[model samples]
Target: MSAHFKINKQASMLMWTLFMLMAPLSVYLMLKNKTTLIEWVLFNVSSSPIMMTIILDPAGTLFSSTVLMISANVLQFSTIYMKDDKFIDRFTVLVLMFVLSMNMLIFFPHLMILLLGWDGLGLVSFILVIYYQNPKSLAAGMITALTNRIGDVMLMLSIAWTLNQGQWNILYMWETSAFTWQSVAILLAALTKSAQMPFSSWLPAAMAAPTPVSALVYSSTLVTAGVFLLIRFYPFLSSTTWFNQTLLLIAVSTTTMAGLSAMTECDMKKIIALSTLSQLGMMMASMGLGMVNLAYFHMVTHALFKALLFICAGTLIHNHMHSQDLRWMGNITTQMPTTTSCFMLANMALCGAPFMSGFYSKDMIVESSVFYSNNLIMLTIILFTVSLTSFYTIRFSLATIWGPSNCSPFIKLQEETSLTTPMLALSLMSVISGSTLIWMMPMNQEPMTMSTTMKIMPMIMVMSGLIAAWYMNTRQIKHVPLLMLTPMMHYASCLMWFLVPLSSQFTMKVPMYISHNYLKSLDQSWLEILGGQGVMSSSFMASNSMMKTFNTKPVNYLMMSSILMLLVLATM
Candidate 1:
């Protein structure tokens, strides 16, 4: 017990020490020298005898470094933000675990180690989601946990498939020819982890957690794990035409559906959640097109801005005593100027405005989709997605920062120091992180410049969507018939539910009857199918047959007994 206690204490100290070291180390690496955090870590690992060196190509280095830098900053932010929270110790431990797992995941040379870190982070995220322990929050946490577990299973299957093909090594798996089944499994895992399409039902529900948990896990790390896996396994995915095609379809569908959902959402966190799903879709599409560097660039920028936005939203909610509905919020620009400013800056970044971090990375993705392989379908889908991206971004910005103040009368509010400090720091990062991406890691490829005509299209799309939103929302226009606008488009939103069926179909073809009526019988025979209907029934029948056979052998049993008695008398 004493030894165990000592080890626990040591682990706690090491966790804090690592965080303290990494935060300063990341800044120094990024600022003093232009070397990214991933390169530095990889260099050190390469030099170490015990730790196997994993050499990162430019794309891998870029992705890993960005994750490291953002994670470091968030960890620093958490120290201040979670200071006054009741479960500070537990929160810190999970935060440390998350950072450690992510870092190890990106850096590990072995596939097994990477999987360990991958699953560890997912588990920690689920725990953090339920940290609040409220009924609604717990329910949401369960959904998030279970959904992620499905992703985990898919990932494990991919790994097992790779191992079966004698590709146990991480690097070898990518280089091997046995990637088709592995890629399919990995893609399913990615779709679920990224909260794409039908699997996305858990994400909005996850908003029941505290805003910080949502910010870190949902917006940045946990959700983006899918994108990371895609990029990391890009070679395998790129090798398969079917994999790329499937990924592109899913990405486009997810982007369109999530953007529409974001538009309709009234809750601040839900908007962010839906926006997260949309952004992930964009990243996945980028990866599908073999634009790994661009995807990583966007992931980094998105993480910084999204984390800032969520923290700012949390500040607003915390000040308002947990009211997250945008309708109840108004004119807080003056009261919470720091948070409001942060929110606006982050929103602009999300919108992919010119010169912003999101703009550069997102434009690269769109341009890649347009130029790659002469596929007009990919281009059109991406173009439409870009428009919706801007539209929903504008909607989210307008709902949170624009319009009349509608503060509720009954709710008492106060700004806590613990919350505002993180919001202020994140706000500053949101503006400056774009410059870091542009200047620090200047792309070898020439930057794509948008023509006046090209620029006009996206702007027009944004404007039209905003106007439509205003028209639909206004009391005078609220009564306008839904048919006047795009009635077909509205109905298509319900088609998001088809994602569940589509993904299931990808795995197995469920009978129409089973798919339709399964819910009605979910409570009854669901366990039988899952547990062991065939095996249990067979076992019961075998036991009954054996009992009858034993009874029928009574004459043989009596004969054997008489023989034994005669043998015993002869011996006497």
Candidate 2:
């Protein structure tokens, strides 16, 4: 290893050690005391009313604990995954800043104070996404940054609006009649961070970053930041029924699109990214349903399993000489037993398989949606989404584990402690975190007794999804043609219902066009006319008038000067 790497590695380890130690203590403190602590008073701003209001609430502390847990393990995994890269130290530094920013966001109860961490997340994430310094990476970074900047602007506007609310701490605001509009802005900000529909293009593009960054981004940091914000804002949002309804609409649409596209995506990382998007939508929907704890529970549990899934995918891609295309891979179950086991387990948990970490939160979400719903259209969409989610999960496993092997001879995956240990840590959570978290943060005062139909619907959908995926992606079904056989259907599905083209590529051009117009008209023509050019033209006219008088006679010049002086004196 390079001499530089050791120093950077030690620094990274030290930083994560501090964060890891704090996470558990925060969770423990929250569980022990039903109250929250807001300390770390670093001078408050009089004008902006910003202060260091670091909250130690159950929701915030628990989410921060999850962030640090996943981040610490991802860092450990990166040491092995990125050991060969020359820029490993730079990656390590960006990751340190990345996790630090999320933690800052986690603890800050003041909206104004949290904006610092919000922008820090955007800046560090852009740098990380483009770390490779390649054309594709740069483009991806631009998309990710610009998309996230939407949330930043929304939050900024909310902060400005909150300035009029007398108190800067949103946690203390029990009544929000005057600031209902600002609350909408906060929800939209969370939507953008979580990459809900219309803003969903950025998450898949963010796979351009190193696998470790992707692992951290989708697992606990960037993608879940919105849900974390919404969870904290739950009390205030209860009054904003319109905002909740709008959020639910956007959330379900995002979930639907991600689910459909995931089943067709061949890129291993992109499928995972899409799945993360879908789950974020679920949490967002839960927020709309007024089940903030359920959303938080799902967010925490999903983080554990998803982080493990990404680590396994990263290792598989690395050992396969950095190919992320699932079509070019298969039957790794026989070759890399440990990674395959982790991958399958993670996927199963993602599908909310019985008693899994995902099942604990997800099944509750499903059952609650049915009991809590009257709109047949919304309920139908939710049920279909559950099935779609299951289908994608099964398809991911089959494509990478049971489908035809289409590559050259495989290289042995590293069986080192660094490589497998983190996955093992998370795999344990994937199996048990759901029940543990449900106990710690239950959905209701007592057990929620759901009807048989509500309970059986998810199982039926999951079973159908499994059967369909096996029918299509199964090695034994080699002779059976897939249902999405036509080129047009495949094209639509693979392009993510053409949302990327509409949202990321084409929608991005609108800003470019506006910027170009601003440069030409506002900066060039208008400013020049009013300021520099206007002064120069006036001076030139004056000079020409003086020269004309000089060419004529002294009397004419005297008369003109007298007339000009008289006009100026009259105006005054």
Candidate 3:
């Protein structure tokens, strides 16, 4: 290992430590300077305002701080988790690039400069997801990349729309009609980046990446990019009815599907990944409901616990001989109490347990919807989604942590303090970040004070999920309860309501089929025959026939003799 290679524990830890310490300076600068633009003067001429730009805005700073904060911890965690792998240096470089790209995307509020980060995340993610040499990893990388490219296309269209606005800077054009289609374009683009609705399956499949990548990217940085973008562009969105309605529809649908799917899922990482999907949907809906502060609040708190959950799951899988099946994991608390406690705490935070990080954000999101929205359907879905969120989270925690000891006595799991240290750091944050953030936030003028009935609704919903999961799982002996195994519902949940097929079998396949057959019928066949090969072959055949005629010297001689005879007769 090189001194700086991630395989070297001290070197990797040292790097992440320095990076983590530096992240807060950005938050400080944003707070102190308030709205400021840093630009490259060389790139701008007096005639045109077009130039490279970086923004120091509150939203951009919040996003930058959250990404680096979570990533710094993940990077440290990776040093220990990936220590056995020889390519840790290469992997570390990829991870560093991933985090750096996120910071750029957040810093440059201008669409032109921001696309650098947008495109960077997509490109590097393809490389990182396919890091393991296997077909599954390759397929996962393709789905992740191609889905993101759709957003990239939407962004290009957005850039073109911004041309109508006379500048590349999105911040400058707010409160104008120029924001019309540009906002819609940004909304759709953000949808793809966040894996909303039709694109939702990619997030779970992305678990094929190394657990550390999942912890850093899917949970905190990459998937959150879209929500972060929406949070930035939210001011312009309030007047757009269709945009708000569309976002609300997609967010709630994703939330319901993800929560139910997590309940049915057996793979630990997939379960956690699905929970992330559910949380992201909530964040999206929060933005739709005109509570961008609450959305940003949930996003930061979700980052802490979500990373903690994934890392703890990764530890269990690492010890269980890389088996991620919940069937193989049982009574983890009995053997690895430290990891178990961290996992439990993280799970509680995810469930928005009382006074925890998620409680401040998640609870408020549902409750505030009362004052923000009048639509009954939207309100019902949000509350129901919260209940489902609790159900799956509790189910997952119970199954793996205290269900039953399904493993053999022969395998002894190693206890590494380094791995747990990162989990502990995040666990502590999961307990404290929300309390600090709500106070630190530039909040709405006042809390949407609801009746005691409305206020306790979220807690009641949480309790229902807890009781329901306990009653159902307690009765199961060797097999899962048949109620949970309902054929149609289970099928939908497990396969993500046929979204994977819709994306792969149809969305992915139709274009691939057209391209493949087009290559066979056109580019590789008749087009080649007509364009390159056809022209060459036809020229050669015609030239060969002419050459054969020219090679017959008698034909040339006869023509010369006839001319000679005509000239002789004329002379006579």
Candidate 4:
């Protein structure tokens, strides 16, 4: 038992060491304005060179470093979270494999070689999602796996389309007349993988996974893969105007949907998952506005705090005997001071509080986006979504960390090193990494001319969201449950505007119904009666009739036998 703990500790340390090494490399690459690509030519197909490629650009290195850092903290936290589980060692291996796949996705630029990591993420994520081995977990895993598979197919199609360009290396491919369907294909792939709009349901459903896995997968690896892909393919996809517009609509819808859903959510993990979804929308919106570097910056910064948020949430969940309902959690600050502080730090960052990591990245995204576009309605929706972010963040904080306790009177909570250590480590990053990365990375720092009103509008929106959420929370404290006040609105928001059913059950209903009817009419009835069973029954009746004839006429049978013997003797 002790050996397993040591193994996890060692693994976490090793990952942290790698993160330290990569972080400096990323900074150096960014400072030098150099991209290192090491390619091994394996073979050739006609004119195109088939090679294994590793790209060490600042973006790749920084993203990899972020992934490693978050994964290390998650692994350390998992040591406590899964301590009672008998297969902790097995869990560690799965996590390591998940990290490996994400690194592969990051460092490789070729579409063909990238599939190794792409498919690996989808496959491993499904395994992790269903790690608990229950019906709900299995269903969640299926939805996650199937939704990701859509992206996998689109990625494969993009690779095939790029084959015509004489190479699969996306780094060297310049936008030309030849770049058409591949851009759309890649966009679809990114959309599905990032859980945008119609594909958004699976993100919340995937909360069925263990908390450590959620921290790693949601914060840096699996969900962010789509955003990373677009950043890589932005040079090509940006030329298509329809792609940008389409993405803008999808991003706005997703952001609104996730924010509303989170406001109504009670489950602690799902709320965090929805918030992650909403953040992904912001990233996509940046991409839609042609701010790839800003999107990338947000992606890296978002990874830091979101991972911390999940770790803190996991600690609370672990101590609460795994009850994730926010209703049962309140006044946690008094019992676990260290954890509650870290939790609020993460939430502050998430809400884009001044000087927090989220403010450095998210504020820029909103400001730059509003400056870039002239569409008032779209901008309005995006601003509203930003407010929604703060709304849910405050609503969640009040319900769980600061609300009155609904648990047993004798419930006890304590901060363990295994839990607090990772939380503290991530909490530090959540505070500083955003500002640090924004300075270090050579992201587009274009000057924007905006009115004073425009400059503070995002902050204003955020404050309004906080006030509204506080009002709602106080009303809930005084009166009936939130569900009772507005049942229909709560229901729609909880279901993500019916997206859950539309994406999952609705999509499957028609096909599954058809299959069920086929089974009943063909396999069970017609095929059984007319195919195998009918043949057998007919043959059996014929044999029985012949047997009855033989039994009823023994003399005739003997005569026939004698005749047969005579004929056999004559032939011989």
Candidate 5:
């Protein structure tokens, strides 16, 4: 084995060990109803000691454990997925730093301390997103970096705003008149990080990263950081008058947008990336409905299966000679039973199939929506989004796993032991993690009673979605009526409501135009006339005039000197 592989193996094992320890610790903390805050005085300002605070609560510990678990599996998977890369060591280091940043965010409740992790994630994710070292990856990385930097800036602004309260600790924060602005800042930060509408183009773009990195980024780290931050700030944000309603609108729009985008998407990784965006919207919706704990529950459960899904996708892509196009894949079930089985499990969880990890959390969130008392339109959209989730997920599974093979016949598909190890480990979690967390976490303390129709509404939507997906697959796009499915509509859906252009080109267009005008009016015109060229030309003209005067007569030179001296004396 190569030294890089050895290092990755060791790191994976270390992460697994930490995960094992933290899992039990979180359970113990939750069962005992305990929260331990470890504080060290970093410094004092105006007699207000700024302490480095690490809170070991059920939420923080459990989140940290999940991060460690996913990071460990991802690192192990990378050993196979990235085995041939020359800079595996650097990749390993970046992965470790990403995990460290997430853990830092989880444990630190203080806004000031949390910025360390927040900024670290943005910087590290930019590097990772551009890991492939290509023009497309570079463009993707730029979008990812710039979008995330908006969140980082918002977070920093929130921290600065909170400074007026004499404390940066979220635990100590209470609602005040000035807190509405702080809440807006925090919400914007979360929205950007979570890839909510108007800020969501970056998540799909970030698929330019390696598959292992995508698994980590989409599942547990960079993308989810926004949801996690909001979970921490729920207490303060829930009190804000406009927060929940505005979030609900954005969440609904985002979920619908992602679903439409995923349904039309052909690239396997981008489809999965859109699904992550969809789930993030649901998490935000849960928060909007005042179900913070359930939102966290969904986040945790989503992480388990999402990581599994990406790992399996990576295996498929690797075995297919790095082809991520879904239409080119099919009928690999017989060739790779273990991988297909694991992939189906993750898919089932994603679709909220019966008793799966996603079911426990997603079902509850859907059921809880009945109690939200939001407008009929928003509620209907939420349910529609749920069905859309199943629709696209089933569509992806059908295209990649059961659809006709469109690629060369010679492509051999097999699961390597190195790849299978992490898949199996995460597959087990995908199967049982939801139940395990439900028992351990205090997400729901009482049973929910609802009408029979209300209880089965989500499953009905799931089945309808499944049927719709099957129908859509069976019918060719050309066969569909132009009125129902126009090329423009198709293009719009595939491009995510034209957000791809809006985010990249449109975002830059205004600024570029302003800069262009500035260049014309200032740099090229006014500045040329009034700055360097103007100064040089004016000086030349004055020198020529002086030479002419001097050459004409020494008396002219005396007049010029007397005029200059008189001006100096006037100023004095």
Candidate 6:
């Protein structure tokens, strides 16, 4: 290799090494003395001359640690999953970029710096999602990029609006403006970034990427960035009643819709994608209802289980030459026993089986939703959504693991290696992390206190879902036509698609028209809108008319020329 090539290679290696090291170091630091480690990390984080400060509160520490652990595991898993890929250097670079940005996102004090990290993450995710460069993957990447950009614009606007309203200082701004229009703007940004209803179409499409990219970006990092943003700014949102209510409605709608959609999806990746959307919705709902701690708690737990689930899925798909359709996959439990077991554990967590990490976090969210909203309607919606979550998670498991053998003819089960280690670790974490909530989190709160009604409802929902999933998977119950059985849900998905136009209608005129004609347009017209016609049309017309008038005023021009000559002669 040339000298320049050598230098580039070394730089890439350094970046990869740094990222791999950060995870273990972070865990060690936390374990040594969590308080001191948090204080030190916060000090470093706050040293940046930003408008906000990084405070090492219990919730922040927990979230930060969870992100660190999952990012590390995903990076490790990627090493094995991407081993045979051609663009290994580029892949590693994006992985490092993702890790760096996520670290900054968690520790940054100011909203601006946080946004910088946020947008960086989105860029890296878009690149990873398009790593294959196939037409379909490229399209998926572009959609994800554009949708995330829309969310970013909303965030930027919120920041600008906040500054415009004289909320320059972070603490003061949040204290004074938590419940204002600014809060609504911020909430909208979060909703979009988290892929809540109407903004959720991009997520399912993103499954075109490699399984590791899906595991890392969609499962753990990028998808949850919005939820983390909301948690980071919880103090600001605490006072906004209307914003809170709106968030609550969005969350319920998203969770319910995602759960129903997951039931319809046969692709393993799409099932996981919808699961992520639903899980994120649950987090948002908790935050909307003023359960910041619980929201953060759920985020941590979800990250662990979801990452594990995705990694296992990646293992299966990779071993089988990227066959991701669950219907084509069946009864690999005998061949890939280790992988199957890990997946089952993660699935149990995902379904929120009792005593798993997912159960605690999910129960916390449901309990908090009931306590904070105190609306039986909201509670019922959330409960039903949880049941659907269980059903789909079970559906995913049965479709992939319990059906007749469809393992690829050419592929064989290989012994587990370093690549599979991360999956195994994550699966164990999913099973055990629930204990963290019981042991660490404050359970004295109303939701955690668990009244008789609260305890009974969650159990009933869980049992009902488990039974329902069992019946469906056993083929004892025929699959219902979504439109016939759940007309409202069918319409809700349609409504989500319909709202795209309605929202576009209110936001901008030309872009809406172009988006409506997106794929059909011979050439994109939105670019023309940005090329200055909207701003220059009237001015250009007026100038042309003025030129016409001037041409008609030839006598006036001659008089002016005569005056100029007279003045020149006088000066001479």
Candidate 5, superposed: residue stretches over 4 Å from native: 476-484, 517-572
Q: What is the C-alpha local distance difference test score of each model?
A: 0.68, 0.82, 0.82, 0.89, 0.89, 0.72
Look at candidate 5 and tell me the lDDT of residue 522: 88
Question: Model 2 TM-score?
Answer: 0.86
Pick by TM-score: 3 or 6, better one:
3
- Candidate 4 regions exceeding 4 Å error are 174-178, 476-486, 529-541, 551-572
Flag regions of model 2 displaced more than 4 Å.
Answer: 2-5, 8-12, 39-49, 174-178, 475-486, 510-572
Residue pairs clashing, model 1? none
Q: Best candidate, lDDT-wise? A: 4
Q: What CA RMSD would you report for each candidate?
A: 8.3, 5.8, 5.7, 3.6, 4.2, 8.2
Q: What is candidate 4's local distance difference test score?
A: 0.89
Model 5, 23-52: lDDT tens digits are 889889988879999999899999677889
lDDT of 1: 0.68
Q: Is candidate 3 or candidate 5 better by lDDT?
A: 5
TM-score to native of every candidate shown: 0.75, 0.86, 0.88, 0.93, 0.90, 0.78
Residue 224 lDDT in model 3? 92
Q: Please tell me which model should have the higher lDDT, number 2 or number 5.
A: 5
lDDT by residue for model 3 over 87-144, one digit each (tens)? 8878878888888899888888788878999999999988988988799999988888
- Kindly give the number of clashing pairs for every candidate: 0, 0, 0, 0, 0, 1
Give lDDT tens digits, candidate 6, residues 1-572. Answer: 23333433454355445546554544454455343222222232233333444544445555656665666666566666666665666776677688678777777646666787888988888888888989988977887888888878877877777664443333455444334766767777777778887788778888887776777778767888888877767776776557677787889888987887777677788889888998898888887677777787788888888988888888878776778888878788888888888888888888777888988888767766665536688878989998888888777878878887676577776645655677777887898888755575653464256578877677688778878877866864456544336666565554343443444344458775877788345334655555577448755786578667676487866875797689889999
Selected candidate, larger TM-score, 4 vs 5: 4
Q: Which ten residues in a row have the lowest lDDT in candidate 5?
A: 476-485
Ranking by TM-score: 4, 5, 3, 2, 6, 1
Tens-digit lDDT track for model 1 on 1-572? 33433433454455445546555544454444443222222222233322243444444444455555455445545544455565565665676688677776666645555778788977888888888888977877777887788888887887677654433444555545556777777788888888887688778877887666677777667888878877777775677768777787888788887876666557888888888888898888877676777788888888878888887777777666678888777767666666777777787778777676677777667765654564677667677766666666665666666766677666554555546665666667667776766676546565556566665555455566656655555546546534336755444453343453354444345575677578667645676656688568876797577667676577866875697689889999
